[model samples]
Target: MNDEIGRRLREAAEAHQPDRDRMLARVHRGMAGTAVPRRSSGIARSWPKVVLAGSAAAGILAVAGLAVAGSVQTTPAHPDSETTLTVPSPSETPATHSPGTTGGTPPPAPGHPNRTTTARPPAGTPTPAAPAGRRVSEGPLSAQGAIDPHSTVYWAQATLTLDVAEPLTAFTVEVRVTQNGGVQSTGQWQTGPAGDFTVTAQESDGAVVYRWELKPGRTVPAARHTFAVQYNHTAGARNADADGYRVQATASDGIHTVQGGFTPAG
Candidate 1:
């Protein structure tokens, strides 16, 4: 029996040898085809993770950018609630004074060492009082006079006698001459002493006018005062065809006034 079994086993082994070699060859070929692409497939599978990491990094960068922008846009808080800064415009700002002294007392001149500075008087201030003298009586002034050298020539002279009831410190005299219904000349004189005289002559309205201011001064007592006046024309004579010339005189002692006049011979 052992002989028979042994022979049978040997025959079977010999018959299956070719099939086994063929099967082994097919398995090796499949394994070679699958092994070549394994590393590349693994790398391809990891690409999603790389992309996700890149997206996450970008998200972090965006969040950081937003935070920086928020910080830049925020306003600084002030410590004091009531305090605020404001800038003044050109029109609203007050003008600065120049680098010099303004109105008040002026500086003394360089050469005037002893000069005194005087303050300006207030508005509507009264004038200073006059010198020491008693108030004179308010009596009318008296005058008696006629122009002298009564000729038909171009020039003439006259004497006037004035009287005042009270003495005066200052006096004023005015003389007016007229001819042919028109004013020919006017003269004014003022003096503080006695024996002050003034003479004025002019031609107007086709006639010559002469005026004189007699002694106007304080030297005249409360009695009579005498003075002379004259008139002349350089270009023309008195109206030979008209009536005599007219003369008018006025005198004032600041408190009293008198007026008189006489025509000279034509």
Candidate 2:
């Protein structure tokens, strides 16, 4: 009876004994069943789960290590900041117009023939009016002076005073200027009531100048001439020349006086 009991005890010990390789083989075989059993509470089934979990953790760590290795290998090869960059050529984004052309016009090639452009003159500009107005002569009436051959201008120097009965606020008077028997008179600016004003003045280039003014404006004119000469010598005039060109323009309550003339003086 003792011998039989010893043999039975040895068989039980061998049957229930745990071994490392055996546990590992069981776990590998357990995967073919493809799912590890969830252990309720004991180390009996937990060893297989432990083996599988260890292997799975090792696989994950290996894959992560490979990814880190690959990143470290590639990151340093390319530059982070480039020193130079290329720009697109002009042909890729051509201009819409030439230097001065409007965008609405056609964009012709550099040497291509383009349509001619024109500009129209501005509107409402007036031409000069013919020179004709009231003329008077108190002394040496109708005396004349010749223009420089370079500048075709004529002047009349005479002294006269007319009685103005109207005492005009503003009115037009006439002066008939005869040069080489060609009668021409420019417009005159009216002087103020009972005040002295200029009849005419010379221009910078030795041209005849016509003067006019309304009352309370100025003793001298302060406006541009709408009537310009055909050939302008718009300077070098004699407005206060006592011997050759002198004018005392006066307008009173009713009468007008113009005192000026060309005397026998070079």
Candidate 3:
């Protein structure tokens, strides 16, 4: 054969000999553990010492921008609980100027109250004289001052116990009272301008005579009618304000009947 196949390929290229020193001693021990080559002392490799260290960090940021524009109005470092300005003194200014301070309209404080009425007046009218002498207590029906529970304007308060004689003649007196009897108070002549007779009906027996009866087609004024039977502050006045009211009488007139009244008012 061809020289024994060229002598076994030259003994396999003389038994592979190519370790290149052992791969150059393992790349010089891996470039001898890196990091360690400073000493350029900056400027030497220079870009003008990095442009003079960036112009000294921009002149320390332009002197810290002129120390924050010279403290623009300093103030508030801490200290203020009351600079004082309270206010609230005018009512013509008189808190006594100052001393415990006070002048008026501040009284109710002793008992605590600024404005209170809640509401009242509907059920009041029945005390027929007992304050000491005006005697006239026939059977619980007495509170006769007539409107003015606090200034009821037109006025109203009627009570006639009977005893007339001081002045009674304005269409011959004719009073009435029968609302629950199902309406029956024929209107007539009483309210001012001198039309007289807002209410003056009599004759439960003593006969001051004429309680109410002017119905000749009724032109309207009243037996005592402002509104027939009116005495309503009914808590505050509304509708049927008033007319002939304030009649307190105690009868001795012409004769006989325990007498007990209160009209004009106290």
Top TM-score model: 1
Candidate 1 segments exceeding 4 Å error: 1-140, 179-219, 234-254
Q: Predictions ranked by lDDT, top down? A: 1, 2, 3
lDDT of 1 by residue, 89-183 (tens): 88899654332323333222122222222223345533222112222223646665455445223444444566666555545443334343323
Q: Say which prediction, candidate 1 or candidate 3, comes out ahead on TM-score.
A: 1
Tell me, by lDDT, which candidate is best. Answer: 1
Q: Give lDDT: candidate 2, residue 109.
A: 15
lDDT of 3 at 243: 23
Count the clashes in each prediction.
5, 32, 29
How do the residues 202-257 of candidate 2 rate in per-residue lDDT, one tens digit apiece?
Answer: 22122233433334554323221121111221123322232222122333433333
Q: List, residue by residue over 41-155, the lDDT tens digit for candidate 3.
A: 3323453454556556655555544444443444445766778887766876653322223232211111112212111112442222222223432322122222223323222
Q: Which ten residues in a row are the worst by lDDT in model 1?
A: 128-137
How far off is model 1, as Cα RMSD?
A: 31.2
The RMSD of every model to the true structure, in order and in angstroms, is: 31.2, 24.0, 25.4
Error of 3 at 247 (Å): 8.9
Distance from true location, Cα of 262 in model 3, Å: 12
